[model samples]
Target: MDSASVPFAALDYIIFGVYLFIIIGLGLWVSREKEGRQKDSSDYFLASKSLPFWAIGSSLIASNISAEQFIGMSGSGFRVGLAIASYEWMAAVTLLVIAYFFLPIYLEKEIFTMPQFLEQRYDGRVRMLLAIFWLLVYVFVNLTSVLYMGGLSMNIIMGLPLWGSIAGLALFATAYSLYGGLKAVAWTDVVQVVVLVGGGLLTTWVALDAYGGSSTGPVGGLTQLMGDASNRFNMILFEGELMYQNDEGVTQDAYQLLPGLSVLFGGLWVANLFYWGCNQYIIQRALAAKNLQEAKRGLAFAAYLKLLLPLIVVVPGIVAFALDAPIQRGDEAYPWLLGQYVGTGFRGLAFAALVAAIVSSLASMMNSASTIFTMDLYRNYVEEEVSESKLVRIGRIVALACIVVATLVAPQLADLDQVFQYIQEYTGFVSPGVLAIFVMGLFWSKATPNAALVSAVLSIPLSAAFKFLTPEIAFLNRMLIVFFVSVALIVGISYVENRGETHPKAIDLDDVEHDSDPIFQVAAFGILGITAALYVIFW
Candidate 1:
């Protein structure tokens, strides 16, 4: 390794070791089975349906924020600036929508996985097909990308070999999670979130203080950064507004990434909704909640966390940019900040926090991917009457298998510049179809099994078509086109096939309650108000 690389000092390793001990112990402590009972699918996959609002809230953010946010999004902040935070800010509003609209519907169905919901709304064929698609994407796209990005950060700051770091992260996540399942993943996440947030703010504060350059403290750093990097503070990117260097060091229009007002009005919603509501690992925490109210409250808590995330994830990247950080790539920005700015005594604690983010997310995805595979595919098709204990065993096995596969695949992502944007673009290929099927099934009574099935099948190819055929169209815009087309196809086919009649399998939207107490109302409105104010200020 080059002398320029700042390897973790002895104090740093000691802090990280303590963090691992506490988290692993916590995960194992809660995962212990009740005195005489053997493990069941609910216990293994859904945390015994015993999670409270606080645990759910913490796990949702833990699962959602990871190398993707800390490393990849920070890299985005370095490349295109605060416009990348559109993902974070818009997600706060989307969480409320998910809480109000989506959570109740899923809870009422009493389902274990998203694929099972598909079976109830459509058919077994749809369920099986989508289950396979979800597994492939979770392992190949989501899980591997996180591992690659997390390793990239570790390599930069800790002076570890990239492949070894990827393997180490996989092993660390597997240690606590394989034995305990969702119960372990979720409860440990409560602790993980604390470490993750504390560590992030410390990093941001120090970086900002350094950026201030003796003018004042962190506040001065902020004022100076704002004044000097005025262009980096923009929330929207119109055509010809700005050009910035990507990971490859190629300058490009920021509009290609942010895509202007579409962030508020168009396909970004499709991505956020699918991620927050429809995606398995993310929503699995909500599924584990004790009741709908608890889940809603958990989502509310997460919404507030989302509002504050840019400070931790984005601001440091901007600080790095204003400082003209000498990094090899965009994803290296956060690690560079750590090596260059973060102090010795605290570096271990900060590094621990980053590890907390990575492993918590890794554990969550492995659990969810296994849930879909074992429940939807294995239990249903492989062995129809498998014992509950056996099902739990299968889940553990599948989770291990998925992690193993991801460990093998993650290193290949080294070529991508801005792994966060890469994940969004590629995941968009599948999101349009996933969103269309769920939205139509939930709200429209006439949506046919055939229509939903066709839309699900076409989501990716159509996205790829728009991507290759019309390269000039920004990906966010392409996703909008694919979504509209999917919706239109669903409508036309449903009307033609079902002859304007309600499908028998349609969710009774009226029966799915929208009732919320005053507390939920205040929280929801608070989220909306904050979101609006942010846009007004940032715009």
Candidate 2:
């Protein structure tokens, strides 16, 4: 499909314009002064730690479900079917665990960033190392990928040029986030999530409506879609089962990337735990919550939202396949469907949703990168006596710089076959070791700082070597191997270093009480149950 050939009508343009107006107004309004009071770093970076559960939850979803999920995951759905939803479904459970097990510690410590938590647990060296690493990833990897995908979608569906789309998105996100920071990002995210989910569902419904030929009714269309694409509905794919024939005319295995049951019990956990529990951008909303209960409740809400994501993001791709939508690449599935099925007025809303996903993620990443730079590095080391006002200024400067770098780098990602999978595969190398360090740091008293440091240093090279030497091993399995090896290294080094010596009191774990929110507990159980049912039904 030549995306340039599709034209949007006036109503679509009006709707899109109105959406932009309302969101910008809402963001500015929400972050505006109450009786002329000024916002400090606490307000700018952490929303003054006053966000409710709903705001926190909505922000989490908005930050997590970006153009990557819409374009990348949907593309995966087009090629690999329902199995790709494990990322979404499994994340629900991961969010629950983070809520119950992780939030208490973070909240008790009153920490602003993930690296701060590491510094509290280990040393400033670990804090400084991870902070710099996270800053680089947020700017180069996370921000760059989101910008590229968002630009690609806009170029395809809205007829905008790629560079123009990238610049527009960067400016749009920076417009609000630079001044209002997390307060603006979190509040605006509530609106973005509504639009994103609504537009996504609208696209899915319209695609399903057009699933069968003209002779078929809506129900018949659905039935025919399922009947024709039944092979694509499985949640657990076995090795060697042919998934899809690519443009190159080569058939790929159903479980080639996911590696079947390993998604359920293996390295997937490492990825999820690292992402949901440790990643700064994703967890920042929770960290900014008013209390541990609110954070837990917020996470529970995100968990429920995660359960519904596949319906909006994944189902449309499957529908596209069922209808044999004339798309050039699997990543074009969502945009192609928009060009075909969505009408004028709703087309703008759909476009707004895509823009919202892109902008929200961009804002979140910028804010987090700022947080790490300003709070972790600048305040602690560069200028310890900096005023809150000066720190906020520094944050804005750092955020803008990061955005500029990301925008410049985004276009380079155009050559990738699937930007989403590329992100996962590359990030997997470090996530395992990071997860191992956090797990041991939190639970194992014998885990020495030197051991954690060694594991962190060696984990990436080990993963790279494994990737090069044993290219046939699935990436997920490689993550599993790296995670265990990292754990072993941590354990062995800790034992040898601490041999015949009394354990240091400095390494004692934080004694934070669990958030005993009944609502959170019930919601967690309910989400887990639903996740289990989804796998059982779809498997």
Candidate 3:
């Protein structure tokens, strides 16, 4: 359990240092001033619809792979076996749909935020409702969970107390993001992806090596975990034992699967679709792309990374659990493993990577919250004719305010059990129904505004009610039911409302572009193939 017992060398530090320099440098470089006219809200929030495929792709990855995955997700994997990886796999199919189906409409219409699309399709009140709901969500759920959990990890690694670590994380993230805008966050995220991914791989490789060389027995350090009764993290499929006794004889199957086929078919898909497609914190990067072609490419690129994420996040935690390192949940797994395994200067690099991941995530959320507030609420309702500089100023202020609120809420993270699951439950209310509205709107011309409105209004309460009613049902299964029911209602309402009406224009498909390169195609297929392989191996 000591820091001295690993293969990590000074070269890791060199790799990490070079990586950090390049990332911060990218942010500073991209922070260049806009040419000619003063910047508008669009420029600040959406990158003026001019970001290339790679920047958008990096931002998407950077935003999505926050400290939650490293800390919360990997930690969950440590406790739950490989089943937790379903989130990543489901995302591949979701992105494939988005790239092929969703991007065309978003780009053609030149939408600023997802809520704006809602306004056009339904009413401004719905947009405002969503805007406020989403903004508060970022403050409480995304931003706060990430910052607090990230601080907890850093604290575990650096041996700092709760307050100091959390405060530092909030301050640093808010400072850079508040100073630079979406452009800053996107560029920083590109850098963060390299470090976070590299550090993740480094930890996994080291842990696997340690697992191979375990002093206790013939089993690899990683495989020994499967043998240990104390480390039984795999999902149990049996009925009648809704909760089983752990090694300590205290019942704790809260994270286990096998309630039914419902979770596999429905529960996970709802979470995945909501997360990858509808959530503002995740989808804002997609919205920032230059055009349909780049947006699709960017989404496909992110899908590719999602496929590889488990190797870094999930696998290492299993290895750590196998080693019987002291940690709680999956959130603390990475930091504990790194502190134990990584050597001196390499430790700094690892810590930096952790900081980068946390900061990038926080910065992404802050910028996005600012984006929603300025574009969806401020411009639409508060101040319609504000100058470009003033809008940017307001956006920055909003970002700062969100960070402050999130920072105050960060400490509350320690109170939740199965923190990731808790987050999914709350967000679930909105995401599935929202996804239905967008999907129905985009593909089905007959899908009327009334249908959209009805689905939006009813889906959340219905999902919540079903979840509440079905105490025997797994959350995932219940979600699947909600998703299908919402979809059905959407179709039914659209049919009823559009009985004899001609559909107005949704998005002009012909004007949209698909200028993809061969590399993108190769990457896309490669990612999908890898995801399929993972499912087969785990299944």
Greater lDDT among 1 and 3 belongs to 1
Of candidates 2 and 1, the better by TM-score:
1
Reference-based TM-score, model 3: 0.88
Tens digits of per-residue lDDT for model 1 on 1-539? 73336877788888899999999899989889879988899999999999999999999999999999999999999988898999999999999989998999999998999999999998898898899999999999999999999998888887889999999999999999999999999999999999999999999999988888766999999998989998989898899798987766688998988889999998899999999989999998888899998999999999999999999999998988888888778888898898888888689888888899999999999999999999999988889999998998999899999999999999999988889998999999999888999998888889988898999999989999999999888898888889889999999999999899988998888888766668888988999999999999889
| Cα RMSD, model 2 | 1.8
Q: Which ten residues in a row have the lowest lDDT in candidate 1?
A: 1-10
lDDT by residue (tens digit), candidate 3, 1-539: 23322444567557655765666666667766757666566767776667787878778887888777887776766666566667776787678866776666666667778788878766687688778878978898888888877877766775667777788888877655676678778877777788778777767766676667756432365565556633344333335434433334466664434343444565676677667766777777778786666778888878878888877777766777667766435566777888787667767666677777888988888888998898899989998988889889999899989988888888977866456666777777777777777777666667677677777788779877877787666667667777778789878876777774546845445666656567667877887777667666555
Question: lDDT per prediction?
Answer: 0.91, 0.86, 0.72
Query: Who wins the lDDT comparison?
Result: 1
Error of 3 at 438 (Å): 1.2
> Judged by lDDT against the true structure, how good is candidate 1?
0.91
| Best model per TM-score | 1
RMSD for each of the candidates: 1.0, 1.8, 4.0
In what order do the candidates fall by lDDT, top score first? 1, 2, 3
Poorest lDDT segment (10 consecutive residues) of candidate 3: 229-238
Better of 1 and 3 by TM-score: 1
Task: Compute each candidate's TM-score over C-alphas.
Answer: 0.99, 0.96, 0.88
For residue 512, model 1's alpha carbon misses the true position, in angstroms, by 1.7
lDDT of 2 by residue, 1-539 (tens): 35433688998889988888888888888878778677798898889999999999999999999989999888888888888899999999999888877788778878889988888887888788888878888888899999999989988886788899899999999887788999999999999999999998888777777776567755676678778999888888788774586545577776658898889998789889999999999888988898888999999999999999998888888888877877767788888888878888888888899889999999999999999999999998989998888998999999999999999999999877667888898888778888888888877777777888888888789899989999888888899999999999988988899973434624344467785778888888899899999998888
